[model samples]
Target: MSRRLRLLFTALALAALLWLLFAAAERALALAQRFLALPEWLQWTLGSVLLVFAAAGLSVLWWLLRPRRRRRPLPVPDRSSLEQRIGQLRERGADTGALAAELGELDRRRVSARVYVALFGEISTGKSSLIRALAPHAQVASDARGGTTREVGHYDGAFPDGRTLVLADVPGSREAGGEAHETLACEEALRAHAVIYLCAGDLNRSQADELRWLADFGKPLLLVLNKADQWTAVERDKLLARLTQQSRGIASAVLAISAGGSERYQRQLADGSTESVERQRKPAIEPLLQALDRLTAPGAEGLENRRENAVLAGLHQRTGTLEARTRAEEAERIVRKYARRAIVGALAAVAPGSDLVIQGVLATGLTRALAELYGVKVSDVQIEDFVQQAKLTLRTGSSIVLAVAGNALKAFPGLGTLGGGVLHAFAYALIFDSMGRALAASLAERQSLDQDDASARLKELLADAGGTRLRQLAALTIDAVRDRVD
Candidate 1:
């Protein structure tokens, strides 16, 4: 199109918009004039109705856009109950020393009456530098290498207000092959009165997850962005805005500062020979200082309950893990014993059989023993039902079991000389091992005897023809046959 035509179209559009505005204004004025001409009482009634409608609309808008309050974290178990659980775990032969030590440390901190603040974040985020900045007099090692601080170190420091504080410098998390150090850092975070989570920039998925986990513990937390000197003012503002949105309910406050880690530079001597010189960078952490001051205003005594709760919650999780592991080991031992007994029973049977028969009494005994170990109460009827389900599964997979047993016999030639009973013995071993493992796994996961899940697992285990399992079963059958002949 020509320039002239384009200009004409734009002018016409503007003119149309102006005409519409003028007509609307004229109509509103006419309505207002007629209303003012009415009786005073009628005019007042109309105005009141308009005001009520406007107020209602405004209230609805506010309700739709309101910010939600943070939800409360789950309550941790009390100290006495936690101690009792630790004692129970110890009685069960689990190594509960670490859990007991955590409780002891909790008591010691309560008596010390010092506010503890832990510095926690990923590697190379300047956690060590921040510690040095916060406690100037204390000697802290700040290296350029990632994961340089490998343990938890406590330094005595004081706030500007003269309140004593103990700052813990913990190992940075997310280092390659640093899982043990990461666990150390997390445990120390739970022990402190508050935590300072440092980052050099916006958080990734892992950092956000770590932040939320700490927040769920109900700790007074501050998300600090270190190495702020790298970004421009506008960039810093935008980064802080994004960090704030990412950590809305999780962190109590988010701020940025330069921890002022040391810097090295080449200097010229009098003879023009260049030499490397290192010096400590000046720290700018006033905002961090102010936030800590407001956050820790309630001294160690005032915040003792929250600190104690966090510690106990951590111990509860660790103890539960140890309990599960111990139970699994014991369950395996029971499974082996039952499998061996099944092998002997199969060999002792006078009648030769092609199909698998689950010895009813022995099956029930194995199920009950595993149930008792896992603390699952099962009735006699339930045990019978579970055994029946297993029989049906075995009927379908028995051919597969016998085929695996035949292969085992061929693999170990010496078993063939034992007799025709050797194949049946190995088949019984496979069947009982599969049944016990499936039942144990289902009980451990569901904490109950789930017939359907256990049955499905049993079918899979029967069909599995892995080499290592076959070898182990071959060895077990050999030992059983040799003992029977002797």
Candidate 2:
């Protein structure tokens, strides 16, 4: 039988015995009262019977009020067991084929000999328009409001070299409340090996914040100053000059373009429209392509290094997700651990026989505290349930004593006022303060269980982990893509 069941049965049996004793005492008291008027001798005999019944009742009460023997503390779970549990959780997560498939797809795209261009900027920067212009089949939502794209969108097409370039369009950034979102987007861009930081012709403060945020990612940024047709020649030149000067010290390349104008330029080509209009509207994106070609040179060590960096970045993201899941699992474990500890500790605190009053008070207080903390109501039945479930025995019957005292505090005004106030305070402190601290600490430790800052940590865990080699490859790949675009 379960420990809880045995404890429950014992409690029920003791309760029945107490009830029988009380019933007998009541019967004797009734008989003695009936004989009072019959005769003096009979009355005296009846009174003696009443005294015996009263003594028995008092003895039963004393037994019920006695403290229980203290129980031994339960042993804490070992580190190895905890680690094993964590490993099991990780294995379960790994077994999900979908995650692996996603990673594999990413890996395949990375190696495909294509210019992987990513369009990124603040909201409504015409990033989608640029993608649509380059590849008409690429379908992306173009919304004027910021942050239209929540997830990264991938577009794949062949470059002039028969190498496929996979273009990614990420979510638009906002001036405020977008750092976390933009950081994630920028990281995705870094993985792609090339970036197109698109901005509308009218660059406002929010647009500026988006560009500034991307600067932190440290990828070779190609600034596509879009919607150039919206500004005059002098205004456009001034804007381009300002941006180019701003990016002078930073290793970012800048170009002004109008996706709207590109569409018009395409129509002009089809219809053999006016050459002067085409020349006037065309944006300077061609020059941007030339710059990318120069940056990602063939046989250069830099291109190889970037490929490795992209792979490692992908691995780091996956590991971060794994770590988050581990922390959540560890939190649940801590809750279970402390729940057992609190119950066992409360049982031990009530074990001494001579200190029945103190033991009863402590047990009552602890149980009440636990119930409050766990958001459960306290009752003798519930206490019995927990004790029985835990498979613990009460030697001195302190559990019964504590239950009676708790009940008494509810009934009698004086005891109720004093005990209820003190026990409530004590219970709150014990459960929330002490147990909460222990649980939080356990969760914190689990969250911090990341691989140390070793250079090989990525290399060992990732499919393509050599950091220096990856950087060089990515740089080269970027150059190769730029050459074709130009």
Candidate 3:
């Protein structure tokens, strides 16, 4: 058919369809007019009955469309129940800031029965956006860059059941110089009634590992695939499938959403001026919020055990940190004790061999002292063997390096044997410090390394003590020398 004929035929079909619809309405009105001619009382009764059925149908639809989160009512908790838990924390030596907060939050829950849900993930993972989207009135501290959230952010919200909630925004963790902050987030996650692990898009190996670690705590977790607005339908589906496969046994649920995003818009003013505006789109977080409500509701499974394990886990982490730090400090003290005496002996050396002999004796003594610092006992024969091996390693690997370095300093006027003595003292302390640290490590591991492995590790330690560390130690020893001379 020709193009003009085809369009004319289509227009005529549309006009015929409209005329038929008007004719049907005219017939319906005529039937209504006939009913109006009946008795007024019968007409009124029929109209009221139809209105009642319409209201019933509308009510059913509204109930079906409401949010589906159904939670059992919470009971009144005993006043003393939370207090008893606080006392237990004290008795168990839960003495870190994170543990302290857990106790405090638990106590609050007991008094008011509020469910705490925390969001945790790596930096720039849309955690804050998720929170704001879930609660538009939410007061959250968020930034676009990493490391802005130095502390946990607390925001209040309510669920569909009118139950209160405390939504916590956990800062990103697991980066260099971010251990302390990450530890705090872990503690927060433990005490929360439920956890939401937020992700910007895909999960790499490190992020996946961290997610597994968090899931191991046994809290209810919902893995959120955020920023859905930024992805195409096909791309989003592919990523969603990958994440859901990755979360197989860990996360209870996975959801995708766009909390908020910027859209460019133009507005005209009353004075005829036009302005550009960057408006934020309303968040699509209703589904995620409903899921959280279901997880934290009263009578949830394993809720009590989850809270207890979290507290105990935080306590264990804190205790381990304290023990490791104590060991390091004690190792430092042992190194300084022997290194000071080695310095005095180095100053007293009148011949080259004399200084070497004094340092070998000091090495043996240092070996026993460091073992004691590590809560180990070394026999005389073992100390002798360690001294011999250490002396051999030092003579073979480091003798030329130190002599060349010391001889270079001899060119300084007015510094005769004293200059050489300073270099020797610095070298002795540096070597002793390295050995003490290595021994502490081996003792901590409760294992022994072969001679070759030990020697290679010693070489690594010495290489790490670069020229800057050498100069710092030398300056410190010079002050000690002056004090001894006085």
Q: Pick the candidate with the highest TM-score.
A: 1
lDDT of each: 0.89, 0.52, 0.71
> Which candidate leads in lDDT?
1
All candidates: TM-score:
0.83, 0.47, 0.66
The deviation in Å at residue 66 for candidate 1 is: 5.4
Which is superior by TM-score, 1 or 3?
A: 1
**Which segments of model 2 are wrong by more than 4 Å?**
1-89, 92-102, 136-151, 156-164, 175-187, 201-218, 245-251, 261-284, 295-304, 321-325, 352-486
Model 1 ranges with Cα > 4 A deviation: 1-68, 142-144, 264-279, 351-358
Question: Which candidate, 1 or 2, has the higher TM-score?
Answer: 1
Winner on lDDT (1 vs 3): 1
Ranking by TM-score: 1, 3, 2
Which lDDT tens digits does candidate 1 get at residues 1-486?
Answer: 999999999999999999999999999999999999999999999999999999999999999777645646657987788789789878978898899889889999999999999999999898888888889899886444653788899998888888889999998888888899899999999999999999999999999999889987888899999999889999999999999988888788999999998788999999989999998888999999999999999899998989988898888888789988998989988988888888899888776452334377678999999999999999999999999999889888879999988877887767766767888889988988899999999999999999999999999999998888878878888888889889
Q: Score candidate 1 by lDDT.
A: 0.89
